[model samples]
Target: MQNSSAFKKRIKRRISGRPHVFFAVCPPGLSGICAKEVARVSQKAEEIFSDKYNISNINVLPGGIEFTTRLKTACLANILMGSATRILMRLATFKADGFRRLEEQIKAIDWELYLPSQTLPDIRVTTHKSRLYHSTAIADRIKPILHDRLFLKEPPRHYDVTGSAAPPPQTLMVRGENDRFELSLDMSGTPLYKRGIKKKIVKAPLRETLAFAILTRLDLSENDIIADPMCGSGTFSLEGAMMQCALPPGTFRSFAFEAWPGFEEKSITHARNRLMAAARTDMGVQPLPHILARDLDQTAIDHLKQTCTRHRVFQRICPVCDDFFNMTPPPIKNNQGVVVLNPPYGIRLDENNDITSLYKEIGHKLAADFKGWRTGIVCPGKKEFHALNLGLSTMPFFHGGLDLYTAIGVIGR
Candidate 1:
């Protein structure tokens, strides 16, 4: 339909195109929820790829989402998604009941398109229900072919497989199941939840990724004032403030895609611009007047301030040091809001070893101080939390442990 020059121009528009994308997740139970998040993000932009993409599966067994997207789209996902653990670039999938068949499939793909000749790739192989199930043997079978494809004289020895150093920034993961094999490359060198802004640390700080997951489940509104009375290192509070900005979880982190052979400059710049455009730029008008955090430990409040400052979110969060029993709710522009509590319990912290009384005291405070506020609390079990006498609903959350899930209800409703 077009001339040769026009065709060249069309090809120029697609950047770092790839065949497929896979977003690694956690806890087989959360696969459906992760699928919703993946779809929500993918609809924003699909032009980076040369053609339309399709979602293949929401894998419950391996805990990931498999979708067709370009390499550029993978880069965008690494910067934008919150629920995913890692973004994997799929190479090829084929029936491989034996090592010979596996090697043949690996040899067919164009490895040169993804890896520079001089770099090293960390290889990880896993097997389930396949005849060629020896992980070490699978690695041995595929490694030589990759080395040959890159024309490396000798494979680099003693390099850490998961290292993010300069020489080798790529990781290849191969999974064999049911007499078939699927290969993928890791586009996110470091996990996405490590936002790189936590300058201060606490003993049992909630994982940032998990924090975002809990926030998403709460369905928070920008207008809802938020408070975390037992905020350790300000994880929940900072997460709430960032949501007001619509900021991507990996906004400040480096990605493994930055080092790929197919890396493109304008593509990443465009992706960053796309994310920034999605960002809430209303600086003068914040979502809520109060997203407050308080802790009995002065060290935690100090750490919260430090972490928030390093994240450039100091103005948006309020940190206080006072015992939950003695402290009153922070005043907000609105009369109603949400109160979050991730109190220490069950060998994590709970230093005094008195979860029963602590739980009772928290219940008393909720009735006395927070009459109309919605509450989200992380607790070990519903029976223990129900002792507080709040009529809250809960779902099983796999992180921290199988015992921990978030409880949601309204205090004195």
Candidate 2:
């Protein structure tokens, strides 16, 4: 990539300088898995963009990875970061011990770099252990400077902020900790989790980013068959097909960077062509048979069918309406493959609920029918997990505002 004269010229003409960006990985449940996904993709990024944008540094944050790369590499990071929630572009970082210092730092950073005069800026701020420790105070301090410097319009709030007029396409976040100030622009507008195709969601649907992480644990091959027996709205199966086809997860969505300077349609088209081309080339194996996905509810199957078709992944997934506990894994060329399940996790589920019996039956089916098959379950707690009684190596992670446990092991091993 570094040797490509075309890429070089694109860099010079489009992204003439370096821009720092970071990945916001999700999983209110487990930061470790997020780390693993970030690490895995970062290596791939190095292999692709190493010539133009070597990763200068990597630091672990509460729910993500803070890493630095050049301006030209942001699109690749967004396209490739499977577990990220948002890729924030670092705009400025300086000392801010007080309000005056904060104003100075904001003033020194060029707001026009990302926010065009016609665009609106949404600001979020957090402060800790410094003279300016109040988050609202910090936001209040920075608002006027943004308007005065960039000629930007502020979204007026009345009874509610959402009631405010919808702005064009930009947001700013200011963070301060221990007298250090840093500003980052949201490069991924809708948070990487929302691809807009997961509309048939059931209660407590698995976040796509977290689902991708679970699918990654399998170390899959083209020869391996992938199935999600409890596939509500088919997140796991759809994600698996996308991974197999080497499609970018954000293929259908627009990004915040597209509205910024030097990121015209031509540049975006160039980057997308290169990224998709490389992905296609690297995917050496043939796409597998339809990803096996089943759910008890016929409505869910119907919805999964519609959603998958909308996302253009319908052809790759075979949706069935059968109860997971009552059914066996579908026959594939490989008798031994993998089954991933997302069961009910009601925070209010108690001893009176049917989950215990459901999990027990699920375990019974796995032992009786799915011998030698790899199994993974996203369950709520020890009660449901122990019900499986499969002695699965566990990975604890959170999803959809709920804490959950993941268990994976070979069935009847």
Candidate 3:
């Protein structure tokens, strides 16, 4: 019985309670919006984790957030979150008053947590605001401490470690405020902003997160037919199509967490399987509804087509190169669809500072031609949307770092 108990303890140590920390970074102005998204997602995470593992402690932090989860729950996050950029496992957090203390705290961490057991570890350091302002100086100070702590045969030597057989972890994110230092291991090697598949970008492209935010705000669903006039790079259209189909946004990209220790291949596989299972074969509603993208620029249309191809949603969308006003909607049996437009603000088309004439034309067309349809227009400013005279409630939305409004007009009495 004693031997069996010891054996169980060892097994538990190997497989139980492995905690992971995640950090979600966003653009400066979008932090509050990102925070709200994080809160909603974390709530869902807590419910899922609690139901599965019978645990419930998810923490939200400023500038980003953190949570404690075992290996499987961490994998669940990668599959479930639309808002999170990357997941980081927290090694340790220490308080440091000065350069000496900071170096000592960094060195004291068990390098084995991050380094391979067989190789001599390489280290990199970064600092902000604290006394150790020079990142290179901080890196220099950290090497000897690691050497001493690990009890290496010889004193440490510095070498350029980039792409080395064992490269140091990409960064040691250090932030200093109020005379104290906070250190974190950058688990997300690349910024979450890079969803990996957006290889071709248009001029003044919208970030994926911002695109998702707009979709969320609009309360879009899979059943709705979506159209994007002036669809630069097809971001809104592509994101909308993917969302409607329940496809994972990260399906095309590799995540930072995949490279971490104890991350299970089976869990990721299962998540992907679940996503595939939920994916719909027919993105269009009955009678083959249209998800349309129209633009005046032939180059923009070509770019949109290429982007749609990369996203594997080319078949799901109909791309046309023509003026938005002249574009016609598909005649689907009896279902109504939404028409969305991201028109050029005065900033892009400098020839038109006072866009009242453009807005008036849009209003006239919608009020006359597409009377029964629902129209959503995204404009650079609130006044521009009001100028459209769509006779509907306007909800403010953010697009590409600009404060915009999405005016929803239900055409026809």
Candidate 4:
């Protein structure tokens, strides 16, 4: 429990590196794709920084990917990445075998470098196989020390652990494993899946991240047409538009790092501008492929229309109010494109709750209309996915607390 000068130095060394470590939390079963996106964003960050910002140590684990880069680069990564759930930066690490050691080490670290004036940390603590096992107790011990450091310049505000007050700029993760602790700051305030544009949703709308993950598996490109026959809320269509246009996913949203101490506002702005410029340059004179968003529900079609118009991709997306069974592919050169389907599952079933018949009908319809075209369908399980009978490869993933599989393959292959 001794807070020696050596311990203070160790903490400083852990937190003061010019190249900070960051982890991109991804959806389960999609970490490989997320890692690829992170690497792509890292290359873009290097271009934006215009300096030798060495991005290295990209290690892909089960649920996330870890990498190291400059702080500004990490902020740009947060904006440019498409598949990650969020990004977190490792702030400090120390060993604290008991409450006294934890408290002493917490007091030894400098907080002003990370926290702005008059700000409090929203601490989330978790402990496993450690002496300080109570998460609430550890958070309680650490909060007052952070408060004392952050409120020195301004009047202290009342702390509310219930979160009735406005959300703090940063969320501090305090993870303890076997007497060792790691402190990480949430760089993205909201989860990356929340693209912040769709104001309307139908029953059981697909998540944006899952949509993007499926699109990635299909090798989607700007030249390839996208058809979402069961386009509920048009998540797949919207994500497809963003990808085709090379638009940064976080452009319409703000991040938690924007309010942190010593955030390079100018640099971040420059990076965004540079990304937009590159997108514009890449889209010169070449028309984006049409994304046909079709559904039987007129209300769903109307909502998709509004969203596409609001996002300024209305021209690129053709919203049609027609049953998928009665639909035909638009006149393209070779009908070489991708068809995505997120039909009803679980409680959103038909009157007889016969999903197999519905899936079989869908498979027949796609086989007839979209021959040689790639198709992706999200189903509740392998049993339902197999009902499609498209010979599509299946991958398991989780969304909305349900185990799901996306069937992917070319129709009539």
Candidate 5:
């Protein structure tokens, strides 16, 4: 009984040192992109918690950013971030060049902080331009460290070779460059981009990150009215609604952090309560500022409706099946809002149509019919961009591995 008590105290200390970290992993060649994303998100959070908390230590990493906080900021990043893939806690970072060095560094830490008894941990490793290029070998090397240290003759009975179980001890993430390794733990089981609720996908569907990019370009506000003219799958509209309502992106899904040792239900509850309390309802006379999504394809419209319903934003949005050129904007409740479109870019052989003509029609309708409204158009190529003839300045953005341009036009009254 004395031995048991001492072991429990040791476990408590280990868990206390393991802080919750939110890592924003960015695509390659876009290194440091996640840092900017983290800063933007952190700024928004500081505004929200201005009275209660003071945000400290915003730092950038190779493919992400790290900040120290006692609150459940991962929940905030999960919901609000558009550019991040996963939000993880940084267990530790140290230099290790080879298998032996990796083992020593990993074994030196107190694994009990992350791993609880009766659970086996899943581990994943990634290497780039390093001596430890074989990730499988690295995983093999670390297995014994865990087995020997934990007093198991074989591996833990709960250990799973398949990735189905929550990784006990912790999920090791080894990133290598130039024969040097940096190891961190993954607190997010799947990429934060999954957002849990979007189970179905459409052809050439925009990722949630790209959708958030479009929203950022628009400079969204809680009270502003927004529309997606070619809102396929309703990604843009749904992300927009969550932003306006101050909903954390992670609210819709489960996180890997929940499985970590010392995870408290009260911490999750406190974070969620703060989010709910911050949620503001629209009480204005007009219907919660129109979030209209229109598409020419009936199939696309059906998919959009299903997605909106699944996300519980169906009632908040107006979906219409009609050609964009023929459709009219819903009567402006206050004549203050913006129209954003993500039209098909002639990328794939099938989508590659005479897009120049399509842009010409879009320009004509915007200039002739929708005066006093601001417009944003996202397209794949420069040739299609010139065809719009909207006389608006253009900004370059990326979506789905393609370089795209957005032309923003302010229609004169």
Candidate 6:
């Protein structure tokens, strides 16, 4: 616990120059939630370290937020924010109307600052409404320049993205629009949604980032209980329980930034340790709210039990193999709670599935047994969404290539 103060001073002293530009990427239409999470996490960092993390200049774009912050804060944001899919460090942006101009722009960046000589850069490019429209052609043009400039002396080698045979390749993202391009380094090698703890999954499991975003819309309090009646693999319950327990999303994973130049491993390790220590201390004094994770499929319940037990959060999440329609709301202290459901879309599990009956059953159960409780359901179609018969407002979003809406309402008002 005492080590955090020293770590705090080191971070405060190191943020001297102009802040770096970073973009927190998320699913389209949820950038607003991701931006809010960034602010909330930075505020918590300030309260803990007694210093500003300098996470400012938040510009919300169509798919993500661009913020200016020091490298350490960017690293911390990767560990803390759950809604962001990944964070990218913007290196440079310039006009690239022709291959020569593209080469010039690429040559201007100091590759050594971000990439080591031995690693093959994994570059991904996308272009729109530009003279240089072919993505592969753009990447092919940039690769040779990078190779000749960075690996002039080293023996040539091939490194796959998996890094199983060699070290992980640093990912470069190039996006071109109207003859101008933005180049960024992917600070997160793998998507942030794969937190490594959600090993147990069923058909069409919800992404953790999406789950976190839905929970953020709930406005949940510490005293509010969470119930996932159709909890296939327990995504909603586990995410909510983890939040209530103060577990950072990146707890069990490594990031691409750890392999970058001048990473400050010792300070980052200290900060992560401090965050874990604080979570433990907070959990010791605070009573955890109950998370009811129920599934009709016994196999799903069994898998969820294993995951919860492996992570030592079994006590907070009560898993049962029972049909959701047969269950009633569990007791709550304040009569305040929410029920979250991600029902089958009738396309994956079974072609003959009757989704309307399912939604109607869900709505009837909630109205009869869960009065005054808030609800969130992933409705795949208007027919199914209206079957609920609950006066819920819908927020449209996309997931799994399907246009969907998150229907939210209070039951039995």
Name the top lDDT candidate: 4
Instruction: List the candidate 6 regions with Cα displacement exceeding 4 Å.
Output: 1-17, 45-51, 149-169, 280-286
lDDT of all predictions, in order shown?
0.70, 0.69, 0.59, 0.80, 0.64, 0.78
Report the lDDT tens digits of candidate 4 across residue range 66-174: 9988788788887878888999998779999989999989888777666655778789998899999999999999999998788764443232221224443568999
TM-score of each prediction: 0.83, 0.83, 0.74, 0.89, 0.80, 0.88
- Tens digits of per-residue lDDT, candidate 2, 1-413, equal 22257644654553546556665656565455556655555565566544545565677777677776665566556666677788787777788777887888788866655554545578888777877888888888788887876654533211111122433257898888889888888877778877656657766677888777777776555556787888877888877777776777876566666656544445446656656665532322654656789887788898888887664544778888987766656665444587888876575345677997888888888888887777778888888899998878887787666667888778776
TM-score of 2: 0.83
How many backbone collisions does model 5 have?
9
Clashing pairs in 4: none
Deviation from native of the Cα of residue 398 in model 3, angstroms? 5.9
The digit string of per-residue lDDT tens for model 3 on 1-413 reads 21256633643454334454546555444455555654554454455444443223554566555555565665555555555555555566666666778777776675533432233333445455565566676667776765555443433322221112432344445555544655555544555555555547667766566666566655677667777777877777777777777776666555434433334555556656666676764534453345788888888788777766664544677778878788766543233666666677744666845576787788787776666666667677766777777777665645556677777656664
What is the number of backbone collisions in each predicted candidate, taken in the order shown? Answer: 0, 2, 2, 0, 9, 0
Off by over 4 Å in 3: 1-16, 27-66, 87-89, 115-171, 186-188, 282-288, 311-313, 330-336, 351-360, 367-376, 391-413
Looking at model 6, which ten-residue stretch has the lowest summed lDDT?
156-165
Error of 3 at 74 (Å): 3.4
> Pick by TM-score: which candidate is best?
4
Clashing pairs in 5: 21-89, 78-250, 79-248, 79-249, 79-250, 120-168, 121-167, 121-168, 122-167
